[model samples]
Target chain A: MLEINHLRKTFGRLVAVDDVSFTLQRGQLLGLLGPNGAGKTTTVSMIAGIATPDSGHVLIAGRALSGDTDPAKRRIGLVPQDLALYEELTARDNLRFFGALYNLAGGALDRAIGAALELVELADRRNDRVKDFSGGMKRRLNLAAGLLHDPDILLLDEPTVGVDPQSRNAIFDNLEVLKGRGKALLYTTHYMEEAERLADRIVVIDHGRVIADDTLAGLQSRVAAAGSPPANLEAVFLTLTGRSLRD
Target chain B: MPLRPLTAMVRKDLQLFFTDRRAVIMSFAVPIAIASFFGSIFSGPRGNAKPATIAVIVVDQDESTISQAVVAGLEQDRNLKVSRTAVDDARERVRRGRTSAAILIPKGFGDAAGLAFFSGQEKPALDVLFDPSHSMEVAMVRGILTAHVMQAVSAEMFGGRRGGELVDQTLAGLDSTSMPEDRRKLLRDLLGSVQTFYRQPDRSAGGTGLRGGLTMPYTVREEAMTAGTNVAYNGYAHSFAGMGIQFLLFAMANLGIEMLLERQRGLWKRLRSAPVSRLSLLAGKTVSGTIISLMTLSVSFGFAMIVFGVRIQGSLIGFLAVSTACALMAATFGLLVAAVGRTPASARGVTTLAVLMMVMLGGAWVPTFIFPAWLQQATLVVPARWAVDGLDAMTWRGIGVRGAIAPTLVLLGFAALFAGIASMRFRWEEA
Candidate 1:
């Protein structure tokens, strides 16, 4: 459902993302695992149409994202690291606003807002202002906003950052449900356990390059063949990306 | 374009604006409070009250008829209060500020007047003492004394004249025996002309005409010529309206900065990611800003009407048309500010400084007439000035609908220019 070819972005003297390429099919949760400053957010931002890559081709549903932005944007949803909910508005209002942005209104908009809220288990607290919400509740609402549009593909950048374990588990369950419904998701995170638990195909990136790309079991089997005692995805990640401090 | 998203944005903006109590108070309450305070101070009469209170000491040394009349006349004047006291007491009173002026009438004051009347060589004069600190009161007392003497002289000269006897005597003195009937008729006509002069009152009081004494030293006549029609100008109302409009523009710009904040927070991105187009988002903000600005102007006008008695003398439609243009111009200005600025702080700083400079140059705080001639010419570049001038033309100039057309067009031009720049430079993300 999504493909990136030879993506390159530079900021003055630093090359943020260099020659990065990946592909994901329908009903697949592709984990983009990277440490800090690994250009994960930059890649996600380009795919989300928030940033322009210096040289690249981003294809979503077989349409070039750069040339046909509206169609590509329509097919994708971006859940940013920060909860982008309006603090002064209620969760329901926030969802309704985002839903209208996606051209859903009246009956359909209401239904979408209700369903998204219920999916995040925030239906009961939909009427409360986001400013009064806890960190976990706000993160859930953020996830709900992305789902309100019901796009074909969802791109999440560290969605579990700063969220509680329960909320993180709920997010993983929601991702599984989305996958079951034949939706494609590009989830970026540094936690190997999250990639092992949720990602159908794990693409480990380091220093703006894709170092390893394989299914969780396939990567573990390869590591075990190297006499690594059937190493888990964590050992495979460390072996591929290394453990250097990325500051 | 879908309006639902725009409506949502407007609703969110209003909710955020109302949630902050400090913003509400600063935006609406402060202006009303200041307007009321200034309105009250300027509500009363134009002139200020007299500060110095004068007291006059009257020494009745003569106790004569003329002296008593002079004292009574001085007592009747509101400026001077009369007090009967000895010379020593009067001097002490003057020293203590109890008395500003003192008059001494000698025992032979009536004899002196009679001698002065008959002799005409040496005139009798009264001694007047006054405190030098009260210079205005001293001058007033001197004037009163001169007037009193003049009245006494006029009464003594012409009070007992019988007009009929004088006419008869004058006729008897004419030489009728040497003249023909025709010549006698001409002489009679000449005598009639002389009689008309004597029938008129004395011209010594400097009364050239009834209106002559009513003329003031400096007369300020304000005639506002809007579209070639002369109308009475209300300077205060024009100033208030101009300032009100300029500040309303500022408030609307501030609201637009809030929109930029939403953009920074990724709210705009989230909205754009939906089915809504960029045009709808811009339209929504512009419409919302314009509506709020117009509401602010209306409320300010309401205050102006109730407090300053400002009346809209021109066509209401024309006023509204110009005001709407002004609102659009303000909104467009805000958009330009937001589109050009990369951050909310920069947007606020630039908008505030720019708006203030425009208002100052536009004659919002000060009337354009008071501005230097060159500065007034320079104000044409500022859109706020055009708005203010347009409003003044509608209200104080009473130029009707036609007067507003020019300013309205200028304001529309400004709005178009600003919106064009904003549209071209607008970006969804920080650069």
Candidate 2:
């Protein structure tokens, strides 16, 4: 549902994202697998329309996204890498604010907020200020904030960076449910196991360029074709980029 | 722009600001406390309050009628709080700063001073001891002493029983001196005239037949200048205006820092990802900042009005115009700070310095009339000056809505300038 074509972004002398191309289809969870500073977040930022690419463009639902306030932007939801929730506000208020940003209001906004909170299992603590919540709870609330409008494509950028295993599993379950509802998601992460479990197809990026893009079996076949024994996503990454995924 | 998103953003900011109790208190309470403090100092005592008096200790070594009359004259003067004490006690009191000064009348001062006045011989000096720290009061005390001594010595010479003896003694001393003929003759004529005045019938003691005893030829009529409306000057009005302007700037600076923090914390990215325009975001922040500043100024001035009788004596519309414009200017200034500073810490420090300089130059701590001519003219560039002066005009100055036009226009001009610069330099994302 989201298409990024030949996206190139540069910051002065450094190239953050170069000639990056990807397509996130309906009911597909495309894991953008890369190490730190491998342009994972930069690619996600370009697709989400927060940062403009120096060349190329992003298309949402087969329509090119135009300027800052284009209606096409409404089809995409962004769960930023950091917990972007307002700490001073209650969880419900935070959701309401984000909902209002997407033009959601009244009973419809209320129902959407309730559904998102229930999916994240934070319905009971919705009245509590986000600052008073645990780290894992805050991460869940952050995810709920992006889901308030039920966009066609959800961009999850390292959403589980500092989450506990329980919260991580919960987030993975929520993403699976979203995928079942035919919501296309572009999830970026450095954790190979998270990508291995959630992503239907994986795109391995190294140094601002995609080196491998295939399913688990297809990627293993490519590794075997290259004279290396297929082990797991890590071995696949090590063979494809000549470096460990963590490195 | 769609109002829903902009409304949401402004509501969220105001919610966050109000939820932080310390921030809310800082926005409102600090200005009121400071304004009340300054008001009490600037507002002198009200109706029927006793006027301030200087304390004086009188040490009379001469128990003569002339010395007693001088002490009585000082006692009758309403400007001095007089007390009789021994020379040692008076000296100690003055040295310890208990009294403003001490007057020591020497022995035989009445006779010696009477003889010197007529014969032009050596003059008897009255010793004045004063506290070193209160040197300024010494001049005033000396002037009062001179007036009292002149009246007492002259009245005693003209009407007292010692007059005949002193005149006969002065005449006897004049014959033995080798003086210039014309000068001696003038001195003889003056003494002879004094003797003739003493011999006149129906001359009352302690009375020169003047309307008031020891009065100046004419008295000065004091009037306070206002905005041609005869409205009384209210110190609380000026204090509230000054403190309101100063603290409103502080509130806006804080809001700017909060905006910077939002950008640093990744909230800006989330906000931009939504279908909201950049203008909506900036407008939301500006609206919230302006609302907060207006509330702060209102509470401060409201407190002044209720407790201190400060009134908006001019056109009410004029006061509101200036107030609204100043608040908008302060809000835009916050945006400017956020756009210019690279980080929250740096922005806070620089904005604080700028705000303090503006407050000082704008005469928030003191009246602008007390500022030097060049400084007063130079401070016109600071927007706070217009805000403060505008409020003053609407309050004690009692000028109408016409007086508010220039200040309101100037403040709006500053707001536009700040908004333009901030929008040009604003970074939507961190570098």
Candidate 3:
């Protein structure tokens, strides 16, 4: 379980994340949908313990991780938007390195690596350097690296952005399995279909503020009440955040 | 914080450093190549195949026979190159670094009142125009001039014609001062002994008696300050000390660039997100850099001992202590640079220039004794100076722990200062 309470972040005169708040229980997935420069990554970054919140709190089952580095950070696994794998190292070595940072060792570490690689469908190619792998294969390996530590919660930002359709579907199936295992997941994406299929609930953000947050039916009803009857999360998101170019 | 993750962090970094051929070449290979280059350049004793000749511009205003003879004597010396020039031109030449010194023999130098040997008057002074920055060169020029003066004074007092002139002049000027009876008698007897000594006849077939000329002007007696040492002022000791420490700092700063790149590449962000403390991350890089520098210095000094004939003249333990301290200073220095520069490209540029200046000011290429007084004092702030001095002491100077204490403590103090700056400024993530 994770909690982001009134989290806000600013870069000079610009507010990147303003009073954004959310909570995710075990076995639930929360899709954070936003256009470019809409603070989706900033809010997720705070939850992943990667960036400091200018104000408010990021708590792991009510334990704060805001003071630079704290032990509560071990409970969260971050799959950043960028591929964070070491290009020179094999996929297996990358997993071992990140796993060691979480204090995982011996057979438990090996088993975790094996399971993560298998789940990502890259277990057969685990010994190959990440640089030599395809974009989709590297994405799989990147996801597998974060899963090596078996964290209580996972914060994945655009996890399938550059992956092929098959790899994207594979990532979808893997998230399903992780949700079934009762792990809290925060998934951020620009793809409406992926969020529609994977997320149980969606929170739409724009310009550093959460404009709408509800279950699929609840959001559609809100959009319907706003003059036009919206059919899906795509119409709900566009109608609420506006159709103008965000940039 | 536990050491496990910190150790893992260091191991991962070292693995990356070794696997990257470019890093390997920059860190270890380049230093080896440079060491061999310096070794060959300084292959001979005193670092050159032939001794450098000191430039002497003589301003001979007194063109008497005695003054011309002194100028000729300076030309005949092996270590000096003599040329005649005006006083202003010679002074300008020395000022412009074209010459080491200028010898000014004023007017009336060879007259009876000017360094008048027979009359027992005060010796006239020859002004030496020299660059104060060129300490070794100035000392050599002064020493050569002093030797020349001693020889000329000896030659005048015991030579054929000058010897007779001295006795006549001394006996003639005896009553000019109106001294006490005892003092006058003492001076007369002393002059009488000299006259009798020069009047003696030459017995050998090839002998030149006192009036002919004194044959050997000066003789040297050599001794070692530290007896039974493996080296004695050869270029190898200075070579290893200079180039070894110089490249070690360079390699250390380059290692710090790796840490800076980590911040740019987002690896530092990922590491910070881990359960580990930020101190552990900083410590990991510091430890890794220190280890690399130590291994680099050890291999360098080891090869220098076998190939360049550099020895550990003092306690090996003391040498180890100084080496370790310097390695620590280099580690902290790299961290401080990474913190200050904050980016890979900027860190590389700033650290390279900084380390180069530190090595130059550290007296690595040139001996500290040869540096100007102010420069020598200013270079005390550079930790590499302590390292070079400490290594030289343990290798050639042979003073042992007592000599190592100062350098060791100073290096540790520098390490602390660099570490303090790093802790205050090191950033976990780019803004």
iRMSD values, candidates in order: 2.9, 1.5, 2.1
Q: Which CAPRI level is candidate 2?
A: medium
What TM-score does chain B get in every candidate?
Answer: 0.58, 0.81, 0.71
Per-residue lDDT of B20 in model 2: 88
Q: What TM-scores do the predictions have?
A: 0.72, 0.85, 0.79
RMSD of 3: 5.7
- List residue ranges in candidate 1 displaced over 4 A: A12-14, A65-72, A218-225, A230-239, A242-244, B38-236
Q: What is the TM-score of chain A in candidate 3?
A: 0.95
Q: After superposition, how far is residue B368 of candidate 1 from its true place, in Å?
A: 2.4
Candidate 3 lDDT, A115-232, residue by residue in tens:
9999999889888888899988888887887788888898888999888998899899999999999999999999999998999888988999988888888888886856665678
User: Each candidate's DockQ score against the native complex?
Assistant: 0.26, 0.60, 0.44
- Model 1, range B149-208, lDDT digits (tens) per residue? 544433422231332233334445445335567875675675565455445675344334
For each candidate in turn, give its C-alpha RMSD to the true structure in angstroms. 11.4, 4.2, 5.7
Instruction: In angstroms, give how far residue B236 of model 1 lies from its true place.
Output: 5.9
Best by lDDT: 2
lDDT of 2 by residue, B1-431 (tens): 99999899889988988998988888889988998999888866444455567899998999888899899999998779999899999989998889989999999998998887666688898999998888878888998899888777776676677866798788778978777888888988988877777677755544455212243556667566665535566788889999999999998988889888988888888899998988998899899889888899898888889988898988899999999999999999999988898899999999999999999899898988888899999999999999999999999888999999999999999999999999999987522
TM-score of 2: 0.85
